[model samples]
Target: MKQSLTRRAMLGALGTAVAATAGCQSPGTGSDSGSDTGEQPESADAVAQSDSVYTNVYQEVADAVVSIRVYAEDSRGGQGSGFLIDDEHIVTNEHVVAGGDEYYVRFADTGWRTASVVGADVYSDLAVLRIGATPDVTPLSFVETEPTVGTEVVAIGNPFGLSGSVSAGIVSGVDRTLQSANNFSIADAVQTDAPVNPGNSGGPLVTLEGDVVGVINSGGGDNVAFAISAPLTQRVVPSLIQTGDYDHPYMGVGLRSVSPRVAEANNLDPGSGVYITRVVSDGPAAGVLQGSDGETTISGTAIPTGGDVVRQMDDTPTPTRQALGSFLALETSPGETVDVLVERDGAQETVELTLGTRPEP
Candidate 1:
């Protein structure tokens, strides 16, 4: 079941707290007590100018952001946040609506409305919902370019059921790999210092200019939080809207970055490329690529050897697993043939492998 405190009741409680604090003040310290400090208050114009960016962004975006409450079959439910992408479509985290039997959404200017899940992708943690009617609010758009590190951004969501709340931070890192289900990783994620808490997932992490940079995924007590990158969102959301699910490109091979130990045992340059640990039988890369066939003890540590080191994929240098994963996720699709450059037997060769759709988790 869903629950919320009315805005009027919340304001009334705040007013009582303020009155109590005022009563506790000393006699001569009141605003009209004639006891004045040297500094004077700034003018309204000055304050307005200083806060214009954040205030304007909130006004532009908050109306489209909605608080979502989900009820499941067993009478258990929780809340999260989402934002409008179009007239009747809302984008949110897949985990937010997972296992829910009924869904309700409340916009800033509208009462709760029934919603239904259009599609959801667990690998990307993105979901789409459709409502019967939508308020007249401009749908949010993703930033055309990837936001650089330190670019100021805002997160608008209902944190801990606090509807229409906003927080500010900067993009701290990008191209991050977030762990997902079944040993898979969500690549090219954005990291931020924004104060995201429970109930914030599925909301838009937007630039100060009101352009979305990422979708809020998870946060912790530490000053670190993460979002699904805009590029990936741009790729996943449309398909989710058209179809009930999104298919992720899969290679079906276990990979590890070639560290110095791995490189030495495999007789390759240190930190050169990604090493193939195990290739799935009868999978996409089964006949095209070769996995490690032997193991060697290097300084008492067993290291897999005799594997094909993937140097590049479709002209993109895969120096690490993150790079390879990103390339596969953003650039390739299922059934697409990709040219893989690999180092085998101290020589370089190109192999073509057709990608496959990922299996259900």
Candidate 2:
């Protein structure tokens, strides 16, 4: 799907051309644009089964979807999609309410109602908001486990203010790491080919049975879209609702994945690992994890050397950037210390440091 927020503005600019041709009534002669006559419908039995499943599912969950419009400084600012998790609580993307001082939530059952931001976690790109009052709205349930790859999934949201739009696709992949607004990567993302446009962010990516498996977040190349996994959402949303923030473990060190080429150039083992390039002063890794002490050129390519190369963290061996971030985000909480094994000067050494909280950006 296209990014609907920007698409909405662009569609407005083409109104004149659309209007000029609005009166022209050439049924078959105008264009063969939307009609693909070469394709044929499936058998009656197949079509009936498919229609029954999706129609029944939509009827059960359609009431939970709503349209969210953000207002900045008493003026219409931006718009996106969101869904009710409870009578008073709604979940959406953090960027939706990042700048808005006021919010207007519109639904089919209940009209517009004022809302206030409860909490927003930038690291996860998820936010919670409390409306003025509770209504008789049905909340969607996130599944306990993620759906398998290639399983069919459905997307529901408001695209360009068209409330309650539906799209269907399959789970393209699982356990993806997507970059957040703050430059920190959010781990365990679910990737799908569903047409999730701009307004679809914060909506539900539900199974055929109407169970929420993910939250539609952002659109990427082709029809590829990324969503926050239901497992991650379940883990983070409760803390956000209760405490207004979620704590993530911080190492305060810049790490890069060591490839085989770089490892060979440094005259180290062929197995790849994580290299510490820089350590923030006064931060958790400061004085504990050494930064690059020198630079060397290997085959016309300059590379940093003489830094701590992480071999393992606890039970993990030769972790990449994704592996390390996932362990910190999912396995360990703030203030928890993990045993770190590093290679310094061709010797194995152990370092123990208490994990700290990520400071505000």
Candidate 3:
């Protein structure tokens, strides 16, 4: 269930978000050479000169932007933003189109066209839409290189159903981890401070050069929003457009990050790594990684004891779940064999496991 951005609320794919609505919410240094240098102040008399590049970018992409209204058989639905990826395909958040079986996409100049879902990936919060009618604006272009922090970004979406609304800002951060609407992990997400209201979820996060860098997904706090990065979009959209699905690598285990108190109470190293709480049946970790064999009391509570602690993966030290997720999402594809270093019994051992394709949730 996707909530309106106006509510400042989020609906996860696998879990429910209990927080209240948040209010609505960078320069390119080289991809990795510099960080965002906070905004500069201008004099009162300066009518902030409008950059010609920005105007050209907007004029180029605006006709490609559309307002998506999704409706179920029961007539229940909500609106979100989307942009044409090509003549017939539009990209939007999975959450935006997941609720309804039918859709109507309204373009800034072309009025409305019927559309159907090509595919929706809950793990990445992305969906591909196919419209029968031809698009008015040119297809969006994406740069393969990552957008660095502090690069100027422009977001054009149908915020609050105001068609073709645009907001500008910088890439605040990158290579971030965010929980998907489905309770899974999305690695290498981009963070921005653009004003993203309820209808901006599927819009394009465009660079000053008019390249699509990210897909605006959701927002939190004041001017803080998260987007699915261009890399993931580039990787998954082709599969979705062709096959109506995408498969991701999966370990299939429940993990809990080690804490100082739990480690000290169990006489184990504190902050050493994450614990294997439970391994799914027939999952990649099944019969390879073991959970706690017993219970241990710590801080007046009995916590699971004797579980295998995973210290690293594929020769890289993944002390945290975030690190592990980054490796799985960004580096490896399904069917790859990886080495997992675990602390079991007393000594350490490396376990070899073949990654599996994540089954549809």
Which number leads on lDDT? Answer: 1
Clashes of 2: 0
- Candidate 3 versus truth, CA RMSD in Å, comes to 10.9
Expressed as tens digits, the lDDT of each residue in 1-361 for candidate 2 is 1111222222222111111111233221223333477655455443333323344455567677778888888674777777788778888888888889888888756788898888899989999988877566678888877789997777888766667667777899987888875567898889998777878888888886778988788984597998898878887899999999888789988888887655875667845678888888989989789988788887788888888888888887756777777677777887888889998888889999788998875
Best TM-score among the predictions, by candidate number: 1
How does candidate 1 fare on TM-score? 0.87
lDDT of 1 by residue, 1-361 (tens): 1122223222212111011111133221224422376566655543333333444566678888999999998998889999998999999999999999999999987889999999999999999999999988889988999999998788899889988777877899998999998999999999999888999999999986788999999996688999999999989999999988889999989998899999888789646799999999978899888999999998999999888999999989999888998899899999999999999988999999899999998
Return the lDDT, model 1, position 102: 98
Question: Which is the winner by TM-score between candidate 2 and candidate 3?
Answer: 2
Candidate 1 residue-wise lDDT at 307: 86
Stretches of model 1 off by over 4 angstroms after superposition: 1-47
Q: What C-alpha lDDT does candidate 1 achieve relative to the native structure?
A: 0.85
Candidate 3 colliding pairs, count: 24
- The lDDT per prediction is 0.85, 0.76, 0.77
| Poorest stretch of ten by lDDT in candidate 2 | 14-23
> Where is model 2 more than 4 Å wrong at Cα?
1-52, 74-76, 268-270
Weakest 10 consecutive residues of candidate 1 by summed lDDT? 14-23
